[model samples]
Target: MLDVLPIFSGDDRITRLFTLVPGSDFEADALSAIDALGGHTVPWSEACDGTYDLVVAASPKGDLSQLRGPHVLLPHGAGFNKSIPHEGSADSASGLDPAYLRRIGHDDTPIALHALAHPHQVARLAATDPPAARHAKVIGDLTLERVLTSAPLRDRYRASLGTGARKLLALVSTWGPESLIQQHPGLPAQLAAQLAHDEYQLALVVHPNERSLLGTYELTERLAPALDAGMILPDSHEEWASVLIAADALITDHGSAALYYCAAQDRPIVSVHRGGGELIPDSPMAVLLGRIPQLGRAEDVAETLRAYRPGAGHAAAQAAFAPPGDAVDRLRTEIYALLGLTPPAHDVAARPLPLPAPAMRVPAAFDVHVETTAAGFRITRHPAGKALPGHHLAVEHGAADEQLARSAGLLYRRPLPASAAPVDLAWTADGWTRHALSAYPGCRSAAALLPSGECLLRVRGHERMYAVQTEPRPERGQVVRIDPAVALSAVHARLLSPQPAPESRTMLNCLIGERTFRIVLRPATDTEATHVI
Candidate 1:
């Protein structure tokens, strides 16, 4: 309905009424989704008897005959390929369900013109319900076109997702017992464990049906590991399309989202569970999956991800959509024709998808990975929930992960600015002069970075924590900033010798990944370590 909304541009020209056709579990989310778009909705129970020129709905649920008008039934999802229970008794091809179409009349005619995405669907309907097929027409796919047309705005979408430098690898799962999350609940967390947190951003793309069924609390619990590892979870259906455009690659199961990915774009893919799902035997989704590079749950996830290159054979899925680029104009014409009115404009087009604002969580604790480079220390981090081998653990004070805090090798609290992502424990710092190492008795060393980009460290036995800043103080904004958590990792490495801390006025080069900070270590004077920055 939003696609052809432009044709009915004048407010006084057409009175647009929206209502929920409640049936599936997903209807619970429909109201909020409509609210987000600022669309006024009438209660489905109350709006049932109202007469209208035409009713544009995506589903065949409820008594559509109540509208007292012609209808245009759009495919609710990327052209339905999965079989579903129909009318509570029998199994039927999802979109081409004969029972649903026959609900309108005795001769197998549907209440609305069955708008399909491809010719294959028309053929599928012809084979099953020939009477309904006669009313069906290929109107191309609006969602697919939106995903493809928004290609130029990938950078904007990626920026909104905060995916800097890292390629976004989305875990696209459809809803069902055979879905990826149901089959491999640990995959997202485990995959995040495999990839460097600094090098990649992992996202979990869940269908509305699945989200509605699992509930946020339960789904968050199941994918906690991945969430702990900083996996993104998008809230609305529109955001999913933007994420698809922004995504560099995908790790998917046999859902329509994956099929759409294959049709709309040629990005790299890693398929999970090749033999699962109640897919239509010769459906485009089934044919493509029977041959994509497979990722067994027991196999090394990182290796599988790196091995699956883009441009693998997905011809079957690519052929799923017909006349895709012309969906907007074609859709407008189709909708207006039902109203018996000429379209306002012949070349009506859809805009790029809205920017995605994913639910992002910053992991406070990390198993800090360090290497002694010639310049100084090179640091990388993994979420402490599932640390890799040989990682030196660092947990912030009062972190949600208590076990990590107790077992951490280095613990510190730094005074952080607003809108900052903590490195070590930069988010918490009450004071500096009154600060004592005894506060973190479980760790060997405690450290902090001041608001002015100064590094401070306190060895366990030291009377005063050292104030380490570059001489003449560092300049106000350098491209590669320092995280006290990362700086402390380098400092910990330097203090491993008899010198438990950097000597006064001694210049040291500290490197954390691409960021290099030059600092002067000094034992804080009585007046210097007495006040907080």
Candidate 2:
């Protein structure tokens, strides 16, 4: 029996495959997915330490070296377009060379299984000279299979959107500076104005990255005009799928939204683009743009909608990319074959996987008491306090090591000053690092001043430190209290001077809520101060 570990990277669309692994009889655990997203599952370090026979990843990137067995890469979304140009294609303008793409965690990691979404992707990989191409195999689109098989779930989603008798239109967005929403900021409200509210219902699903940058509350407020016009914004991946199923027509910038919606629902599509040119030449977006009506202005959306019909691109999309109906079974077969074992006899019913819970933003109320010890300062949490499980206690001090919170909330060592420069006792979760901070709001900022009067900044709740300074330095022994509530809101900081001097060491001001704090810095000097406060 092979022990399989399915690694999920917070993309809820990818985690949909977890629903199919129940009856496989392979000792499979979803520790990686839980780690990538927020959940109280097995820790990633424990899951990766030779505990499983095989590791399956949703995307082609990630650190899979810890596994002693072969790893499998599954397509997280519609992999119809080649992310990088073909091996020697003269498209250097896209900056997608094989080497650069591979280094950035593209699907070209050797010694791994590359499961293609369709035969077209297999052919595309075969044409490349990369070693990853040799491991590529067609496994079909598992997400599409999940969407198509679940009728009741989809209906519930549609009903929740109030799609009673009106046609639904989903406007999907992607990341990057050149993404659809970035290119046309006014597209959502513009499209809403063109469609009749009584006859048509509009739904918006912005990329999770974009949503994170602007924040859910901020994004919703930004799109209040559309929401007031009866346009629904699906907050979760499940709701997004419901909008896709209910949508009679789809309008998207050249992202996976075009391919997945068009292929799965056979819906008519309108591809939007900036007037300059296509983002990716000869991509699936280009193909869809050529087949469907391309819009450059919001004024043209209504006209294009009138001319387009449902399932107009079904035949062409199906012919170009054949998405299999039995993708889940195909994936299971591939897994068994790779392990040289017979397929287990089981009826794996298509069940709905739980949607990920939204991240918490405000710091939880905790009863923290500080005590001084010989080694350092010790902080303890009262038994009656409440916090999200798996949160590690991180101090704002630059030299402090993160301590995991025990059931009794006995966090050992490092006491910060109660009136010190906004020393934050942050509750950080696993996988809430600098790179992945946009997804979680709870651990966005954790900054504090050390005993030496040097400022230590932790952005997105990660341990990466930056030395910042403010003009008019605080007295060496004065208890300068930087408000934790205010200092955590600074988005970015830069040292204005190369050298840290009393006169020149000033930091660009950061916003703490409505207030701005100008921090000053001095070179990190040795200090023997025992207690901070």
Candidate 3:
């Protein structure tokens, strides 16, 4: 039997690619739809141990050099197209680090199976990186294929969102500091307010990174007006896909969401500018954006929505990336060829797998147990204990010296246990911390007590854990207590610095027992204050 491991990092789009192939085991960033796909989930480190027949990754960042077997590069989206400015230009090529390009380029690269979206991408890779071109095979867009083939699923999704008898418009959000929503924070509500509720419904599908950076409460608050206006928020990739299919028109920033939606549904799209007036020069997103109607101001969104036309630039976008709906079959054939196995008979009648539940913020990798005690809480790790043949353990957080057991579970005791002492925690704009914490004796979990008296518990690699305050007061330099409870494992906080350095900045004032701990906030020098959050 062929052992294939689909490795997914933080990108949820990569997870969608897994839905195209059933029965393939996955090593994802967390417990995700992969679990529903009937494959056991393993850590990326374990998956990279090179035991599988093949490893498939969406991004080029992972350490594939250690792989004992061949690995494939399944891009997260369509590759850069000709319309993308400077993509094939020698000037752009000259600007890139040759060493970095060589590492990711075709020649002497680790990628054994590189899947391209179209012939244009293949040709570009050949000219830019010949080795990559030699290994490249055009598989088109798998996500678009899922959208095109799964009509019944789309109907169910629309019904689930209660979007009936109403023209739906999807406002898709992307990550990055200067994303569309970031550029226009009130765009969703502004647009929703302009449209007549009886005629059209609005839905917001935010990129996962936005939630990570802003925290759930802040993001919810930012979009509160829209949600109150009956704008549907589809939290999972499956739901988002359905929203795209159900939407008559799409409003997006400079992200692949617009491109994917347009290519798959052939719907009209309204692109919003990112950062300054200029889009990312020579990018596919910029190229696609140029072809469609755009809105620079929130006030103009209403007019754009009313005048939008479906099938605008759909044929050209489809030709550039989404070639045919047989991408899944083509990918399977490639996988079989790579593994030296015969392709299974195609099942034309097989309906696409039902979309799994929306992905959760904290992936279900290990069972996290929180035991509240007088001194604080005891956080323990209980492995699923399933027999994952040829798998290992890799922890994304915590002390580097701390060892992960391949078979045994870990017990995190409060008060700093000598065996697992010296836990380090770092906070950033992104919700999750960099390292995991191993409980020691007297080592209680730290929390950021919101001004509303609601406690936000700390999870090692998550930023979405928080109790909603009935009345929220969002302000700058508002002193909030930081509580250290035994029940909490890690404290997740987002620090927003919109201006340059002052001498002293107070992040949060924590009141624990009789003492108060003042946390200091500082940003790296020379970077813009806006860049911090």
Candidate 4:
């Protein structure tokens, strides 16, 4: 009889049997636990036992070559487990493996075994409780549950979370001398006494490898006093959580620790990430980092901490923790079913609906009317809608270039980096070119420059009138007019045309409303103007 009570798979209600080969009682115990839970079992033999569908063998000298088939192996220990993956073709057992399961056989007959203690039994084998709550009861009675039960109540809860009167900021500090070195990289050796100061407590939890070097006098001077203040150098997750739960705000160098603390506490986190380090947009760390705002200064952190209020923040945090509808429960059920186990009949309760996706301010797409000649490149702009596509040109009457330049704002002229590909432009007075453009610089206009002068302006809606006063020397009124073929009104015709490449030798400045665009008029090259300016 095996004690399956220690390895109850959480959420995965699948039933499966397991056992270990002779001479490995330690592994046998683990396998017995697995088998007692309802997993299928097969005898390991020289000829390979056909009595069972899956044969598992555990031995230092076990011949795995004969045990070959589409089978999964539960190797004992991480080192041996990793070796199995590298050496044998068998899929080694791991908790995450979709096939480390209970159901088996071609006929799909359900294997019967002595029932395991329950899913929560896995905690007995763990050093510490896993962060994600195991029992529904623990989460069901949370304060979040109250707020989630009603819409108006939810709103009030969220608003309260955001209404902190003071922010209690905490900066996590490590103990090792290397940690001290990281914190104060520029401490002078000569003025050591003068520089000896303690502003905050340091919680020094250092890895064994870092303990030796931490005994330096200089490191002690820098770190000890802070610890005396209230700083903690905690090594374990529990310790870190305790500190974070009490502190109003958190600051950290990396994103993972910060995320765990923030999500658990619903505390506002300020990331003090390493300079020049950017979290990848698609990674889990990045997803977590998105929740916290980045604060550049310790003072800012102190200020925010001074105003933080726990109860108020709890509602917002609870709302954040709540899932969309009963999606989480549904998912939990599905995962268990897939693992070949009957899910428990946990009662579902009503909760507030998920908040809507955040509103984003997306700029309107642009239409470009372009033409090039011996003089320069010309372009116009208008909003994205097709209602009046070719009817709106930035340059109207006597004020095309200036109006376009002003509308373009900083988009008109940009210095190309030395490493970038060279640009080309062709200037012709007649048969001008037109193109639709997007991400035009200024709010409503395009950028353009004509032979008349340099400074830019804005072109009104659907009208061929440009407006702005760039140069003030002589009386070149703020706006001027250029060719109408490449005017803002001609945007539609340009967009409808097939894209062509610009000549390598032709480079010119393009003006779309007030923004200036540098277009390489490479006829034989892709005309997708890499926005330089």
Candidate 5:
């Protein structure tokens, strides 16, 4: 509905905007969004008493016979891939379900037009309910096209999401008992616990129906753990389109998001809850699911995420839509014709998705395990909120273990204040000893990670603390990337080793995730380390 608002933005003579409340199962949900759009909402009883040029609605549920007007039925999702399981008189195609379309005793569809997004829907409608098909028109998918149009702003979305250079794995679930969120409630946090937050980003895309069904307060509380472990949830349903645009891959169920994202992105999808196939068997989604991979609770998330690719059948996914990038133009033409007016002379193009403003909470504490290997350094980090076991605890300022006594832990600076000097970004471990020891009982090492790919380290047992920062000199033609926390953990492993490396050697290798960095080590005094270590 938000997608089509711009078409009516300039129409002055259309006068009052009155939304008919036809009592859908998700009526309040629709009304809330309509309320956001700002309009006078009229209930069905009152709506039938008045006449208008045209009326539009997304859901076909409930009795809309009392709503008198030339009705335009819009696809709330990607051409209804699900069956109307509970629409009485046995299940039927969701969008063209006949029983919900006509007046209680009448045979004809009250809707003047059934605006579909694909040719396939028109054909399906014709086969299942010829009356609805007579009014169905393929106008392309306005939402999907808008997402496709926003491709050029992918980086912008990534920035807004704060995912940085990491591959974003989006967990998209629709509302229902069979949805992924309902089946595996902890998957988001569990999947995130497998990899360091710095190496990969995870987010949950929930259907508005579920959010409305459970109510925002309850749904947010349900996602508390995932949110605390750095997973983001959009502020509103409309922001989800941009989330799809920013995703590198998808972990989806049998929802419309899976269908639309498959069409817009070439990235692979790992289907969760595939067993409950309530899918329209011949629908594009069902066909795509047959070719895509399914994930079980026992499957290795990291391995699947890194290895799977949406190989082949991309054309099949695209065929579900009525061409791309021109939905706004096509939809506007159909709607204007219904309003008995010319679609303003100017050309129409699908606009970029709205900027996503999501509440993203990062892990405040981590249980880090660092090992010295011949390959370099192997580092693993898990959030403290999870039940996973860790040998060492690394806590931040406001983390759960922030006040816990740590005999041997690594302590680092928190995010710098706005007034902090640029040099404050990196400070040596020795000078930080006072702050670290006071903060953590057995603080052995401290580090200040820098934005310029440098880490200033101070190991207490070493002779004099160094004030110099270490810079990487990648092995010939190779680029060095550093995950600061991982880098600090690697340095901790290096310092606490059974047989430490010879201090005389100034150069060493450190590995984090799959990337290796060649760092130069040096010996410096605390005063010299004040600027950087």
Candidate 6:
């Protein structure tokens, strides 16, 4: 079952008959009009048993909670003339409120105008004073009960109307010749004119502005030869609906008439660019509708309209704008998984190896890498990478013959800070040494120094340590290779001794992974080696 909840306000009986109505114009008159048609006085009672499987409302004032069923029609207005009457059991003025009209004219009440539903007599109305036909719906903002009239065979009426005349009608404004050009700089003028012409015939109905002859003149002059002349312009809402209900397409500019007409009738549409090339981001038309195609050039307008014909290829065309395959395929896969089915094998790759962990903890120091295991714990003492949470920092060395096993672990409460630097490490083979740099604030720190005779220095030297600073480089998940010889030359390092003596000598500036360590060459003099090394 299809559920539709349309809001309208014009005739009170339609509201009283349905579950919900969006209010529209001529509130008091609309109620009287519906009262005159239904003949039966409806009492204030909530009907919610699906007595009617479908609820059709034309005004916005009717409450939808009263009916539990499918709804059709949006209780909105498309400037339908409710003050005028049509030659039928329904009277226009009676269906609308005179007081409401006065309030609206006086700006005391802001109300929307709706079109009346009557698709059968559109062609006849157009042949006469089309504006005089009152075939449109009206919805007032203040009351929904004013316009709801019980139309006994609305479904049958729709079905029958679908087979007659044109399938859709679009109303648009034509202000200037450059309007189309400004919107679509790439389009040609002649093509746009033809598309507009084709939209009228292929669509069930069309209502061009009577005040402006530029659009009509252009259509009759340049596009008339190639078009079917059966398409006629109607001036009234009655004629608009008669064509709209049966139309395959509705093409128009961004006018309120086009906006509410397509919305109220549930018609597919094409909106031409009317003003500046750009559309307002928060415009009402964009918010309430979709599937609107653009028609800028004269030659393509007609073809664009023909493409949206009800049975021609709307589904495919619409799919071109919004594809429908991804969600369905995803659902199918999920359903199979729920059914305990082995999913079909596809090309999938293996995961990559993880990086090392932080050698030690330091507050406000991020980018510490570390990895702990039962066999042993490995820590990368660098401040330039990430480490997993819950890594073991301290390890218990194995007994005389047993293998080493990690016993304790620490999970970090937050991510490590990147602002801290790794200065040095002091250690024996047993476990992690005291690693230090600048203070890590409330965290442990230890700085390994060069031998006493050699001296500890910054990137520059001990003399310039207070002023030494490094430049930032772009390195994300990467390793850069460098040669010691070239690096020494770049930093202008001076050798302390021609070739270091044994035991006390080593390349103190070499950085391996995260920890900085040196390769010992030979021992220093007895006196020098005694105190360091």
| Best candidate according to TM-score | 5
Better of 3 and 6 by lDDT: 3
Residue-level lDDT for 448 in candidate 6: 16
RMSD each, Å: 5.7, 22.4, 21.7, 26.4, 3.8, 29.5
Q: Write the per-residue lDDT of candidate 5 for residues 386-430, one digit (tens) a residue.
A: 646565666554344545326347765543445456554543444
Full-model lDDT for every candidate: 0.69, 0.48, 0.49, 0.32, 0.68, 0.30
Error of model 3, residue 475, in angstroms: 50
TM-score of each: 0.80, 0.53, 0.55, 0.27, 0.88, 0.25
After TM-score superposition, the amount by which residue 66's alpha carbon in candidate 4 deviates from its true location, in angstroms, is 16
Clashes of 3: 24
lDDT rank order: 1, 5, 3, 2, 4, 6
lDDT of 1 by residue, 122-226 (tens): 888798889778878898887777777887888898879888556798888888888888888878877778776666788888988888888888889888878
Worst 10 residues of 2 by lDDT: 1-10
Which regions of candidate 4 are displaced past 4 Å?
1-168, 172-223, 264-268, 282-301, 304-332, 344-533
The Cα error of candidate 3 at residue 116, in Å, is 1.0
Candidate 2 Cα misplacement greater than 4 A, ranges: 1-51, 80-112, 151-156, 275-279, 309-312, 340-344, 352-533
For each of the candidates, give the backbone clash count.
2, 9, 24, 99, 8, 111
TM-score for candidate 4, residues paired by index:
0.27
| CA shift of 299, model 5, Å | 4.5
For lDDT, candidate 1 versus 5, the one ahead is 1
Q: For model 3, what is the C-alpha lDDT against the true structure?
A: 0.49
Candidate 1 regions with alpha-carbon error over 4 angstroms: 1-11, 35-38, 85-92, 105-112, 313-317, 345-348, 358-360, 371-380, 388-391, 397-407, 412-436, 450-454, 458-484, 497-532
Question: Could you tell which candidate, 4 or 5, scores higher by TM-score?
Answer: 5
lDDT of 4 by residue, 1-533 (tens): 11111123343543444434443323443444455545566555633443334333222233333433333222111111111232223443222122322222123222211111112223321212222112111111122222223434433322232211212344543322223236433222211111111112223333222333343344446554343222334433223333444444565543233433444456655444443222323233334434455555433544544444444333323322433244334433433443456655664443332332111211123234345433443444332231133323332212234444334322222123345436755422111111211334333433334433322222223222122222222224433333222322232223223533221333344343343433322222122122222
Q: Is candidate 5 or candidate 6 better by TM-score?
A: 5
**Cα distance off (Å), candidate 3, residue 449:** 44
Better of 2 and 6 by lDDT: 2
lDDT tens digits, residue span 344-378, model 6: 44421111111111112221222222332332222
